[model samples]
Target: MLRRAGLPIGPAEILAGAEALSRIELGDRQQAQAALRATLVHRREHFEVFDQAFALFWRAPSAPGEAEAGEVELLDKAPAAARRVSEALGGGASPAPPKVEARPDMALTVSAGEQLRKMDFEAMGAGEIAEAKREIRRLALPLAARPTRRFRPNAAGRRTDLRATLKESLRQGGEVLDIRRSERVVRPPPLVAICDISGSMARYAQILLHFLHAVSNDRDRVSTFLFGTRLTNITRQLRHRDAEVAFEMVSHIVPDWSGGTRIGEALDRFNRDWSRRVLGQGAVVLLITDGLERGGPEELARLAAATDRLRHSCRRLIWLNPLLRYAGFQPKSQGVRTMLPLVHEHRPVHNIESLRSLVETLSAPQSRARMPS
Candidate 1:
């Protein structure tokens, strides 16, 4: 298994591994694994392959004879990585006869990393999440630029500038023939993201925050706000080149991290204080929350007012709810019902693929986004 995983293991290493196993109590699986790894694995980079192999090989009954029987079943039920290793080692089922004109091995197989892209964020382990973060950082978020009332000189513009035409004619020895044109200036709209960091959204928030951090640094006019029981602007912190340091700084700054969800209060605060400051010049707003508002007599009223203001302030308002990933999800909660008709768009944000879709959507005009009357 070690050799198949591209590790260098010889007869001497095998003997040493046996000797190390004999020295251990063998009663504890962790102790046995440590002994074997210490004896057989010489390089740190091979740890991932070794761990997968160890899990597949050791997942059996504790009893000796029963374990041998279990090993055969384990091989049959082995995961994709273990299956590849088994096939490489020639221990798997016999291969089919080659076709007359067979395609190369490279044409047929998909890498594990490709498979990870489709996996849900909530389902990923720690290692996969770390890998996903690296992938997120590589994403390019280029928003489509919109035309402004401000103008710049353009030789081929449709609209004629009478003053510029007269000035140009004066430069041309008073020949009243040449015409000057101007075009409206184009610039990307400001992007403001209000993300939920409450207890229910804890797992997905950290991963999505990495995406936001990448977006913040990739372009200008991008603002990021995290809300748990309160709203905290992390745009400056996320601008740091180092993701770890940026997240660390955010952890220190956000006092309400993993606290209760008070969506109404957070949005009210945003509308009251931050909205006018950031949501100017036709901004795009991404509200990342599950639409699960805290209960109170004033909660719905406050949320309604805030959402209405937010919608009116932005050119497009997109709500990214992780709960929408489920096939059977419905707008059952009062908060969800209230939000459904307010936003320009509602989309899922539970995986890397979804984020990629978001980037693509942002780059294009929001023609498909359902705008409220």
Candidate 2:
């Protein structure tokens, strides 16, 4: 059962657990738990799952009426951890309790982190969001490194440096014994995030800024901008070491917050002012928005022009639209239609799973990403 919960309980660990139980008094539940846990639980995070599995697998069989008293309520009010553990034991097999409340403490509290990883951001409570922020800070953006024009000295490099080889041969009595080689330098591309802070996207934006803040502090030459009515360069503001202090600085400087979106105007501002400054060295741009433009047909032309220019300015222009969460999502809005074709990829950003996918995509193989039109 613990193995089903994704615990690393191999045959060796099982044998060890059995041997551990032999050393402790079987009648004392606490001693047995501690011994098994000491032998089987390799990770601290797996302790809860180990405890729950131990309780279920080793508990004395329930009396005739005792099982009937709480089975329905336990399943109904089960927390995410309990639900995960149940999935191992054939969850969703019973159609019984639709609204029964279970005991929180006694309920299996396993897989909470797994549940959190898949949870939608907007649906999360304050505590969950806080937990998520800590998780985000721990993430390392897996940005692939691109080969630069300049070459560096390397013994295993393909290209031979004739000049260096000759110089080194002088030390060997003018004998060209070994040819020195050099390889093109490889460096991770700069990352720039242009996020929407419009009323509709504010909640997702709030969460993404935490992610961006972590990214900004993690590496060098990362830039960030916030756009609603106009584009506000937040690269400087987000550079603060403290996330809370950095966001406070951004909140003070940015004039438009949770306001109407101006897709065309914001892109124009980015293309004209910041493109040349930051979009150098194969920069990867993350354009986050919902694509619900409030502009007219005329503005759509400008939107198309700006998006095209921005796309040309960067190596990869990824559109992280929260609207893509919908199953039947389409580029029906003027803004999305104008921007979608210009981007290398159009992906969702509504949940943690999507965010993790984005991280994976960024760290993908050197070849640029190309999503379907």
Candidate 3:
């Protein structure tokens, strides 16, 4: 029971527990409990879990054709442990007696979910993409909170807050015995995602947009913009509660969905019109593209200028390219060379595991994200 409960009890501890049980009177629950706990448990925090297992182990059978009394006692109280024990003991059928049929909808296959985590988004089929969307919904995106110029009252703050002290003094006959302190307020910076929806990036974009939608609803101050032949701000459309409805509205709003790539022009439009509105307050920008510019040197020059402006406006700019997953990838194109020096971090966004790694990188301190040489 201790091993099944995930306690660190070895064979030696098991034999020791058995010896203690043999020495103690089985009729005395208190002495037996103490002896078993002393022999089996090694940590203070695990005492409660051990106590639960002990009580369940001693329970009597309730009736015929029902679950074992031990399992019945734990099914409602310590469900996670009970479920773990059931799985460990032969398909959860032998030790724990049978009950009503389990709901088919609640059955989550563990191996299938694990496989999806490492599967590449571009290679996923229709059903796999649907399952990946469900998995994406369960993911949590945590941003690194930055300290702001604004201050809030803090009792443990070192600096004196004269304004707060004066306000509090008014209630105490204008005589202040305690001086209040204040600390700078901290908040998550805005997240701006500039995604490429060109033909080559269509499959990756669909999956990434789902991820963006999840991040958008997970926190405040998130803006999303999609670019193909032209730039379109679908931040408002993506704010819808329903993902399907949001994507449907986005399709109608964005005229160029899986069209030609005009990276320079789209970026130029964003820098000229939308940069100031969303790129303030040390924003973090996620640039999702394959670095495949269609136009000539003039367009590449424009893209370089726009990317420079974007880098200057944000605290950290991460470039996520699915092409980076290629083992023989080289920055041979003018567009790729121009973008290489501008981003703080360059990473692959080809799978769920990569996305999770991105989340971890973003949660770290800003100083940790270094510009690639």
Candidate 4:
């Protein structure tokens, strides 16, 4: 349980520590306990295992006195110990259980959702990503139909329908009536993600894919694609429950894993083949790339034109570029300049905070201004 909680020790170390404690000799029980504690604390790695082992050994069924309160406190605080290890290793602890708030949709509201989304991707490595995945799972929302307004009769209000109410009263021998009404909620839009898997984007692609998997499984009408030399559809592979399995499946299906980027060719394919199919129902397209096109400005221009067409077809087009993370970033590259003018929202996609921002952008209403022509 401790290991699962993110402790560094394994079972072998625990057993070894136990054996070492068993061999200790001392006159009194207190003295024996002191000796065992000293042996266990000799190395930092043994601290956690020793705490558990010492508790089990000294507090055995037939053992003399009750286990020391300090030992009990230490055992009780195992989670804190695990957290320290996690911090030292540069990974965050599992989020605390969400505080329950009294509201109409209490279950739907996640308090830690914003914090989880704001995590920095560059500072976080594999372990932090793993933890973030768990947090995403915990806060995952189920797909539900849009909310509809309820109507009830009220005594005081503007725009009264007295004629209709009177007609009903005439048929029922005159009874007082009241009414209330509210508008229905709009349904969530479909999500379309276009991730760049070219050599320049390789470093952040896999981690972003993990986030995409979480979104894909949690929502309906989610589409994912990877582009390099060619466009590869990865929506089917990401449907699996296990992230590791899903990524492995994606690897098998996408032949051009990390190679030359042909953004123009890939966008051309998506425009011709996928735009009508997946871009229907006012879907939002998340274009994730560094805007580095290998083929010169002509191909890049063609790709940007195709993307502009896609932008017109979809409800919204968001361009997520890792290059935006740099303070000195400028649209100096031909590809960046061409692609920038075509997207509705240009944002950074380097870390967790940026990803959270992407989600917020998706949820917002679409803007009316056209992409720069």
- Of candidate 1, the 10-residue stretch with the lowest lDDT total is 78-87
Lowest summed-lDDT stretch of 10 residues in model 2? 67-76
lDDT for each of the candidates?
A: 0.80, 0.80, 0.80, 0.67
Cα lDDT tens digits, model 3, 29-58, are 999999989987765545666776666555
**Alpha-carbon lDDT of model 3:** 0.80
lDDT of 2 by residue, 1-373 (tens): 7655545455667899899988889998899889989887765555665665555555456563554344434545444444445556553453564774866663566577878887877545445767888888877897888887889899999999999999999999999999899999988998999999876777688888999998888899899999999899999989899999999899888877766789889999999998999998899999999888888888888888998999889999999988888789878877787788888899998877788888998888745667884
Candidates by TM-score, descending order: 1, 3, 2, 4
Evaluate model 1: give its lDDT.
0.80
Candidate 1 wrongly placed segments (more than 4 Å): 1-110, 162-180, 368-373
Worst 10 residues of 4 by lDDT: 1-10
| Root-mean-square deviation (CA) per prediction | 11.3, 18.2, 23.7, 16.5
What C-alpha lDDT, on a 0 to 100 scale, does residue 276 get in candidate 1? 89
Which stretches of model 2 miss by more than 4 angstroms?
1-110, 155-157, 160-181
lDDT of 4 by residue, 214-303 (tens): 888888889999988989999999989998899889877887655578888888899999888888656778888988886766797797
In model 3, which runs have C-alpha deviations exceeding 4 angstroms? 1-111, 166-178, 368-373
